[model samples]
Target: MRKVNEENERIKRRYLKYLKAAKRKDPSTVQKAADGILKFETSTNYASFKKFHIEQVIKFRDRLNEEISKTTGKPLSKSTIATILAANKGFIFWLADQAGYKQRVRHTDADYFNMDAKGQRVASAVRESPYPSLEMARHAFNYMPEVSEIDQRNKALFAFFMLTGARDGAVASLRLKHINLIDGCVYQDAREVKTKNSKTITTFFLPVDDEYLTCFIEWVTNLRTEKLFGPDDPLFPPAEINVIDGAFKVVGLKREIYKNANAIRQAIKEAFTRADLPAFTPHAFRKTLVKWADTHYPTRQAFKAFSQNIGHSSVITSVSAYCPISIEEQGELIKKKKKRNEDD
Candidate 1:
């Protein structure tokens, strides 16, 4: 029993390199493609790519349908199944164009890896997700206490997320120089900040001037004066973990930025939990900002800038991705239309 297929492994490495270097795919995307290919190979008992058959594709799909999700206590979602199939489908199609395996695997057979029409529709359908409202976000500020250095940092992290609508990755990686207190904006320099698609963006502070924004400003002031953090120092610096009493504890703040957004997410969870509210992931805050813009901004021109504030290149991109109309909102819109028509 072979644990690995050398030929398939070699091809997979080349494919992943192509995905990252040529296609400019992020590490996570490339890793997912590799995982999908591994799943297919494992199902066939690590069979050689040269001995591939179309029947194997059908068998894999059937097996996937039978698989139960550990999280939901039901079968895997249509979207998950579609993703798994799509990744394999792409790899199989690409594999067909390669030497040796080309003759054995027909490029047309890769179509068998595609999801059914029903599955496709289910995968494409958007489901409503919970997001924080402006009121709820403001309410959270009350829970944040600025007692210790770490406490102030956590409070500031929450305020910063709400103010900028920044992705957690960008938040974790921002430096002092990237922020402009006077201008009221964050410069997400892609060379340093971990922005999506490495896009450089400048996000202005949202029009919410309460304790939340004040807390963030105080922290910035403290960093500049009390802490004496230079322009290169992180805005929300990493926690200094110390082995006090032979046990690790977060004692203070480090001068360095976090390697990833996990700490920032933990802070959000803690803040929400303390506020007696359901935890919203950092990315969900962007949706909240978009929702805020939709109701508040009277003109399209204002809304366009609001969209740009969250790093959206186009207004349509912001509307299509973030501002999903709720069922209640949809009913209200329809009622308004009826009233207008009746009056006319």
Candidate 2:
């Protein structure tokens, strides 16, 4: 049995390169597309693309419906299924135009990659996720124990995320000089920071002043004065793991930065779980910020700047993606309309 498809692999590499260079897609997005294609190929027993049939897509979709999520050990969510389906659909759509595949595969067959209408609705429906309120998140930070230097760094990471609404990747790549305490802004220089789409933007400190923001500033100050860390050093430096008594142990801290967002996410998950709160991924903090802005901002321009603070190019992009009318909020609006009708 074949473990790999050479022809498919060659085309996949080209497709991924196209996605990255031409489409300007992030690594995560490209990775998902690659994973989806790999999964489909494996499911088809590494069948040659030249021998493809529409029936294979139908079979794959049915199999996907019955698949369980690796993380939760339950059936995958509609959103997850939808994303995978879309990836598969896109690959086939693109594949249909390829040299050998043009005759074997039909472009219209890719339509079979879509979920049913009801399934599509379920996949697209917005659901309320638990995000810690500003006050609660502040309390969580205050409550965080910082006996160790590594602990201080971890706490500061959470505080920085809340204060700046920075994406985790950018946070991991931030340097001390990127921050200007006097100006109260972070300069996400694309040359140094892992900004989305390699965008360079300046994000001002949010109005969330208190112990949380104070703690972050103090940590940076301590790094500069006490630890003598330079302007180029990481804001929340990586943990220094040492071998203690022939066993690995987390000791103090290092000047190194995380290679990626995984450590940041793990720390956030652990922090929330320890706080007895539902897990809110780092990205969820952006939603929390948007929700906070919606109730606080008086004018559209103010709200638009709030969105720009998080690195969005436009206000509509922010509102459409992050600040949807939540289910509970929709209910409240409906109740108000009912009362107005009764008054009339």
Top-TM-score structure, candidate number: 1
The Cα error of candidate 1 at residue 191, in Å, is: 1.5
The number of the candidate with the highest lDDT is 1
Question: What are the per-residue Cα lDDT tens digits for candidate 2 across 1-344?
Answer: 55988988898898889888989899999999988888888889998878888788888888888999889999988888888888888888888998888988889978988899999999998666677888767666666779888788889889888888899999989989998999888999999899998999899989876666797888889899998999888888888888999999987667877799898988887788777777778888898888888878869889988988899999987788888887788899999999999999
For residue 240, give model 1's deviation from the true position in Å: 1.0
Colliding pairs, model 1: none
Give model 1 RMSD, 1 decimal.
1.8
lDDT of 2: 0.86
